[model samples]
Target: MKILYKKGIAAVCRIAALYFMAFLIGACPVAAEEEQKTPGIHTWADLQEAINESGPGELITLTGNLTALSSDSGLMIPAGKHLTLDLNGYVLDRNLDSWGEFGSVIQVNAGAVLTVRDSSVSGGTITGGYHNNGGGILNRGTLILESGRITGNTVLHTGGGISNDGTAILLGGSITGNEALLNGGGVCNKPKGHMTICADVVSGNQAPEYDDVFNQGTLTLQEAEPEEFHFEDMTVVRSYMEELAILPFLVMLAILLYVVWIDSYLSRERKRIMLWIVLLVLSLILQNYTEYRMSMQVG
Candidate 1:
């Protein structure tokens, strides 16, 4: 009975150790195999289909120009998903129709995130909107635009280029040649909305009031500075140390010490002591190698 109890306790400890190690070192779960596949959008139908198939954090790329064939709202991003639409130098045009009850080119719903990059939105005409806004794009969720163009869009009331009722980040883009009947010819930041422009151009827009941009909410304009790195700076060394994640290493060391204690208490076998020594050496080697790689990346 005594021998059996000792064996059971040893087994439990071994299982616990293995579980803890796995919890610390295991990789994050990957997306589904189907979701891993990136599909290209060419036509309006293809773009809609791709959006439907996308999951959160998925990327969809546009390969060619897409013209809206119907008078419906063009390309809605589903709620609760963070989707990135890479235009890849493509154009999305509304075909000069007075369409879209809401947004003409793209509509981002509440609790969703949409990132548009390297594209152009043109010829969008939004009439009779819910709030008479967003001719080119309507964003109720988070919207990010990078290296794109918004031009030749018209709205009946406000926000000829974009109507942001949520958060919008414009990074290195151009908003030009858009017209709004009332306010915000280039972009409208609503009362509850926030717009941040970092190194973007807002020019050649027309509106009855606030021709370039209308901000009823929080609007931040920041100039981007070119980053310069100097190898001789001691701050680089401090940053590298922070990136090394020393807390995790300390926790690992504590766990290893506990493992050693357990082994010492259970058995005094030369084989088990040798095994623990080998594991300790391996752990140190791995930790040092990881730290070296991180330092190299920082440098």
Candidate 2:
């Protein structure tokens, strides 16, 4: 019975060590698959259909300029959906009728989330012709502007560039060359709105009341430097760390239990000591490699 018990403990330790190594191997980054290119959106119908069919948090990129028709009111993002539009140096312009009448170029419905960014350094433009209000964008949901140019939009009432009734966060962008006859040539934060401008260029806007911005709700201008960690890079590192963190603790616990429960057997067994050393060394190597990869990604 003593011999059988000793064999069972040894097997358990071996199994634990194997599992530890397996987990460490799993933490290594897999070779990325060839990415499939998302087709560009050209026509208004295709654009709206893509938005309607897109899942939450999906990214849609533009390859060419798109102009809204006179019959079209605006591009509407429905509630409860989150979408990101990456303008790859393309324009989103609103087409005006002979009378130069049109609605806002884009309207974000309440309970939705929209992020507008430019993949190219020159950035993309969101401009419009004459409109009643919010010539460029009328946002009632959450809006995140990472990088883009909102310019050359003229409005009769307010918000020539952007009308934010919900939450708006400007991480890096330029809001300029927008004109409002009444107020808020660059941006308008309505009564229930909340806006935070961290890094943005707001100038060359003309308004009868407020030249650049009109705020009735809460508005904060941080004017701070950009954050070191980007979302995409951080996500990859975080997932690997979260999965890899548990294996070390389990391996140490197994080693501890083995030492405590069978000290005499462990001391007599040189093989067991070597096995522990190997596992520790391998664990250290894997941990260092993972950390190095993370540093490279962030740096």
lDDT by residue for model 2 (1-299), tens? 98999888877876775676566555543322112223447787678888888786666777688988767667888998788877767788876532254477788899988888887877798877567677788889988877889888888888888889999887777889988899999888999999887755576799999988899999988767435313342223544665676576557546754554554545546656656665675666566556644443321
Model 2 pairs whose backbones collide: none
- The lDDT for every candidate, in the order shown, is 0.67, 0.73
The TM-score measured for candidate 1 stands at 0.59
Candidate with top lDDT is 2
| Candidate 1 lDDT over residue span 167-221, tens digit each | 9877656778888988999899999999987754577889999998899999988
Index of the highest-TM-score prediction: 2
Shift of residue 231 alpha carbon in model 1, Å: 24
**Residue clash pairs of candidate 1:** none
Off by over 4 Å in 2: 1-39, 97-102, 228-299
- For all predicted structures, in order, the TM-scores are 0.59, 0.64
